[model samples]
Target chain A: MSFPITLTVNGSAREILLDDPRVTLLDLLRERLDLTGSKKGCDRGQCGACTVLVDGRRVNSCLALAVSLDGAEVVTIEGLASGGELHPVQAAFLAHDGFQCGFCTPGQIMSAVGLLREGHAGDDPERVREGMSGNLCRCGAYQGITEAVLAAQGATARREDAA
Target chain B: MNRFEYVRAGSVAEAVAAGAAPGAAYLAAGTNLLDLMKGGLATPATLVDVTRIPGLSAIESLPDGSTRIGALVRNSDLAHDPGFAARYPAVAEALLAGASAQLRNAATTAGNLMQRTRCPYFYDPASACNKREAGAGCAAIGGATRLHAVLGFSASCIAVHPSDLCVPLAALGAEVEIEGPAGSRTVSLTAFHRLPGDAPERDTVLEPGELIVAVRLPPEAAGFAAHARYLKVRERTSYAFALVSAAAMLRLDGGRIAEARLALGGLALKPWRAEAAERLLAGRAPDAAAFREAAEAALEGARPSGEATAFKIELARRIAVRALERALAGTPERVPALPASPFSAPLANPLPSSGAIAHA
Candidate 1:
């Protein structure tokens, strides 16, 4: 049987008709909503390539069934930039050379943003590495990724302090 | 995945009723359930989404100083909760050490306890796994037994319960509250998970259609919170299943062990509690000799399958001793500041001190 669900994606209301209850949030975003930024690397929860923010918390979109989340506010990688401006995390990734192939970059940036929001992106590099360990980059970009996250976290803290 | 009917349960009664249907399963975080379904290991015809059920996600403090953690409490929330961490550091650390950050954010308390084994044979439909299919035959008996159980394992199945939170929960003596068609009931955390006997498919003792409501920790466990430690040894530094893990809690009276609780994971089908070890440590001075004896007693009846798992018997003994020693040292306010190069350090050399226990 099919299930119907309504979600607020990227600060916009989305009403979708899901014909299958087994459709994952990753498939819904990629196939239905056309938000292809979230990659489907493993299709399992092991790889964090499909990481997204649900109600402002990081979760594996590949394992999240769309039908189960009726009114959740989902923020994919596409939702990060606003008004042609890159998010601090996205900009930091570019500045720190955090990606080689750019496949896991979306999930990495999303997870880093979530980590910063969760107050886990401390100044320590090991803590940042531990906090962002969910998203793996096969290109061996962990050093750059950790540096980018730390930089983004500092920028975020400075912005918050300015306000 | 199979075509299934979905029901978003609004109340506890509705969830139980929907779960009572044939081939129905309760869905919370869907971290394990969805993965199994996608792998064709599980084919539930109906999924009752209980994440929306009210009052099942709260973490409340009881009047007796004990904590009641609802089954729907996410692992990330529980681990990051400062109050819960201060009251139960071992449990919090175990949860943190289990899965990655994204997984912990989506995994629920009951779902972590209910997660199935990560045995490759179980995921392979062509393989003979009694746990996946009853009476199918045991393929993991002699194939890749490194991750298999070393204790309380029957010939039919040797899969270990891959849960880091359950190890500390077993040591804390938590009570699992359940809601079923009949009424609500509570069971000891140690008794909730069952050993793999002839019927390896049955992982838990809960009846069909029963749903976990909350897990309540006893008030006495609060006293041991300050002297608790959880140590997990795995193939990788993080985001890997435990090779051998130990959770230890000690209540000391002027260097004399007043009480002790020890539980081992990744070495048994279920979370293995060291009752014999606890008994040996009680009323004795917390010394290296006493700790060694307790560790030896904990692995008294352990039987490894092959050379691959033979290392675990020795590994578990050393890990248990280290966990107890750390617990006796008492809990630090926060994790010690890491050195500049934490990841570059070798994973094999977990023990830095060149003191006794050279094998570690």
Candidate 2:
């Protein structure tokens, strides 16, 4: 049976019309809404390519049912930018050269942004590695990815001070 | 993944009522369940999504001094909670040791406990797995089992319970509060996870329609004195399932072992407690010899599947001993912390000190 779901996405309130009972938020975002920023790599939740923010927390949208998320807020990679300005984490990904194919870049950026906003920054590299361990890059670009996040932290601090 | 009827529950009792219906399952976080559904491993006719239900996601301390962890508490929130990090450091460490920051941010506490094994055969539809199909013979017994269990193996199933939190919680004597059609009943954390005897299909003793509200941990002196370690040895250093992991809590009086609680992960059908090994450490002086003996006693009955993986027993033993030693040493040395990014700096290599080995 088709269920009515009202979800806010990328700072816009969306009233989606879904028919399939098995359709997930990831499917709706990509297929229905054309929010193709979130990749569908390894739909088994083993890969972080489908990560998005549901109620201010990073979730693998492939595993999140659309009907189950009624009246909830969802954030996709497309929403990370404000007035065409990339989020600090997204900018950092570009600065650090965090992607090769860029298939997993969106999810990685989303997860990193969520982590940084939640206050996981520290002087330790191991802590950062552990924090960002969820997103996997097949190109083995972890070294660059880590550097970008650290660099982003510095930039974010500067922005905070400037404001 | 299938055309299952989705029901958003309003209350815990209503959720349990719907769950009691045949082929109905509770959907919390949906990390594991949705993954299994997409993989064609599990197809429930009905899914009772409990996310909208009130009072199932709050983390509060009970009036009895016990900490009540709601079933829907996110893994990230639980790991970062000051009380959990302070009182149950092992639990926090284990949660962090499992998935990456992103997965934990969405994965729920109850979902973590209910996560299935990452066995290739169990995930593949064509492969024979008793857990997936009742009469299907296990392909893992003679096939690829490098990541399979070393302890608590039966002919039927050998896939280990994949939760890192339950191992420490089981060791610390936590109780699970479950409510169902028959009313509420509290099961000891030790008894919550069941060993795969003949029925590998049944992972826990929870009856149908029973929803777990919270996991209550009683305040004990032993729980506070508890020094714990969660050693996750995977193929890669980060974001990988454990090959063989151990969580050990050691209590010391001066320099002698007063009590020890040992639990093994990625090596059993359930979160396994090395009770026999712990019995060997009571009253013994916390030393290298004592640690070796305890490790040996715990791994005495272990039977490995292959020649390459037999070393896991020895590796698990050593890691267990070393982790306990480091946690008990009370060493003030702080390793360089890593940045929150994928690679902010180089990993500092710290060798395990022999003198720091505790009997527990």
Candidate 3:
């Protein structure tokens, strides 16, 4: 059966007429809305390739049923940048070489942003590694990813301290 | 995934009523259920979305010092709650040790308890898995049985309940509160999950349309929180299922164990509570020898299938002992390193079959 869902995505109100209740939030964002920043890796909860912020908490979009979240706020990787400028996490990824093929970049960046907001990414490298363990990098770019998260966390903390 | 109708339940009554329909499944978090649906394993005609049900996500401390955790409480919130950690450290540790941060954020307490096994044979529809298809015959009986159960396993199915939270919940003696069309009822956490007997298809004792509302932990269990530990042994350090996991809680008086509780995961069809081990440890001094005896008591009835899983008997024993030792030491900061298996090491004579080693 078809259902009509209205939700806010990337600060924009989206009114979608969904024909199938099985459509995942990942598919809705990538296919229906044409916001393809979120990548579908395993299409299972095991891989965090489709990580997004649902009400400011990181969750696997591939596992989130779109019909279930009718009025929730969603923030994808595409929403991270504002006014055509890169977010701190994006800048950090660029500065630290966080990706090789960049297929998993969006998910990793979203997870990092969520991690920093959740207060898990501390100054410790081990903490960063554990915090970012969900977003895998087959390119063996963990060292760079960890470095990027740590740097972004420090910059965000400094910016907050100044404020 | 098959086409399904989705209905957002406004109240508990509405949810229960909708879920009472045939081929209707209540959707909470949808982390595990959606994955099963996508894999063509579960195809419910209607999905009753219960996430928006009011007051199902609150975690409240009762007047008796007990805690009532709502069924919709996310795993991450439960793990990070300082009050919950102080009252149930082993539960918190088990939650943190499970899945990943992203998954924990979305996974709910009821959802975690309701998660199905990760048995490869059960996932493959083509395989003869009794748990997935009744009377289909268990393929894991003679197939890759490394991750199968060692205790309370039947010929019908040997799959284990893959929930780290359940081990500690069983040890803590938590109670599950449920609501159905009739009324509300409560069941002991240990009795919630069922052993795979002739009915391998049924995972829990919940009647049709019964919805788990919350889990209540006794106030007395908080006293054992200081001396509790959870240890999970897996192939990888993170994001992997346990080969053998143990949860232990001990109450000591002058270095003598006054009371004890133990539960094991990845070793049985349900959370295997070591009642005999708890009895063995009571009135004994907390030491290596006493722990060893308790461990031996815990694994007394373990029936390993073959060479691949025969090692689990010993592995579970060692992990149980280590968990007890860590509990006594009160060192929750130290994560247990993965124990090396003797079978994994290279052998000098690979073809040796019961060959005696010559003394040099």
Candidate 4:
């Protein structure tokens, strides 16, 4: 039996129905909502391709069931753009050459944004690598990805100073 | 995944009631359970969602100078907790060592303890795994078992319980507080996870419909001239499973050992406590010879299964010695004292883009 589930996604109230209690949020986003930005890499928790934000916290959607997300707030890569302009993290990815095949970019960006919001981005490169180790890219674009997150941290800091 | 009835439990009592029902399982963080269900390793007929139940997510200090971690507390939250770092550094380090940031955010304290093994045969439906089936012959006995067990293994099953948290839990004499349909009970961490003796199918001593409420950490007196460390030797630098790992907490007195607690991971079906090695360390001063002897004592009875795993015994010993040495040299990080930070930090470098990557 599919139950009626209402949650906040991208700042909008959304209703989703799920039959199997095991149906993951990754499936609902990719299949039901057609929000293909969140990629499913391993389906297992090994890969971070399906990373998303639940109540401003980064989570692996592939391991999260849709029914468990009732009344929770969700954010996907699709919501990264504001007023048709890319978020600072996305812009930093472009500047830092943070991706190649880009399959893991969505998850990487989502994770990076949350990292910055949490204020873990400092000058240390090792810290950056450890924080971003969750998302894996077969293209071996790790160097660029790390650089992008660091760059985003600087930009966010500058914007905060200006404000 | 098969269809299963679902109910959002309002309280711990309700969740236990639902879980006690035949084929019912509690759903806290779906990081492990959902994946296992999709892989067809577990097919529960009912799921009791317990995340909605209040008071199941707090990581608070108890009156007894111990800490009580709620069952629904996320691994990431626990890892970053400042108090956890100060008191139970090994527990936090173990959490940080397992899984990625994203998975850690979703994996709960109870779910991570209840996670199944990563054995390939256990996930393969066609493979004859005694863990997967009650009476099937064990294929891992002769199959590719480079990642299989080296101790506490039986002919029935050879799969290792793959939780880094359990290692420290065993060494620190942690206890599990659980609520069930029958009543509430507490089980010591060492006795909670059982070995795959004859019944390889049972991973934990938990009864059906029993909900893990909290994990209690006993208070430890400060000033162990000895230090502690968690040494994980894995296939990769990060995000890889440990081939053979060691968690050791040594208390040094006058450059000699006052007390020692050691546990092994990735080599046994359950958390392998090195009682033999621990006995050798007590009252003896910490030194190279003492550490080596302790390591050897820990591995003496370990029966290695495969040709490649023969090295794990030695590897585990080396890690134990090294970890003890490090612990003796300096203070080991217990758990973090602060609450979990919501921000994500930069981990690695940005991927090189043809169009130039943007800097933050």
The lowest-lDDT stretch of 10 consecutive residues in candidate 3 chain A is A120-129
What is the per-residue lDDT of model 1 for residues B45-78, given as tens digits with 9 covering 90 to 100? 8899999999999889999888999999999999
RMSD in order of candidates: 2.7, 3.6, 5.6, 7.2
Ranking by TM-score: 1, 3, 2, 4
By DockQ, the better pick of 1 and 3 is: 1
Error of 2 at B125 (Å): 0.8
Displacement of residue A143 (Cα, Å) in model 2 is 2.9
lDDT score at residue B71, model 4, on the 0-100 scale: 90
| DockQ, all models | 0.73, 0.72, 0.58, 0.53
lDDT, candidate 1, A1-163, per-residue tens: 5566899999999998889888999999999999999999999987799999999999999999999988999999999999899999999999999999999999999999899988854788877888887888999899999999989989988998999
For TM-score, candidate 1 versus 3, the one ahead is 1
What is the lDDT for B137 in model 4? 83
Clashing pairs counted in every model: 0, 12, 0, 63
Interface RMSD of each: 1.7, 2.0, 2.5, 3.6
lDDT of 3 by residue, B184-296 (tens): 99999999988989998999998888999999999877889778988887877777888999999999999699999899999877888999999999999877788888889
Tell me the whole-model lDDT of each prediction, alpha carbons only. Answer: 0.87, 0.77, 0.86, 0.79
True contacts kept of 3: 0.72
**Candidate 2 residue-wise lDDT, B5-118, digit = tens:** 888899997898899999998898788888899888889988998888878787787677778899999887887887666777777777877777777877888887778888
In candidate 1, which residue pairs get closer than 3 Å at backbone N, Cα or C atoms, i.e. clash? none
Model 4, residue B284: C-alpha shift (Å):
1.9
Model 2 Cα lDDT, one tens digit per residue, A35-137 = 9999999886778899899888887888788888888898999998899898888888898898898999998898787767776655346666677777889
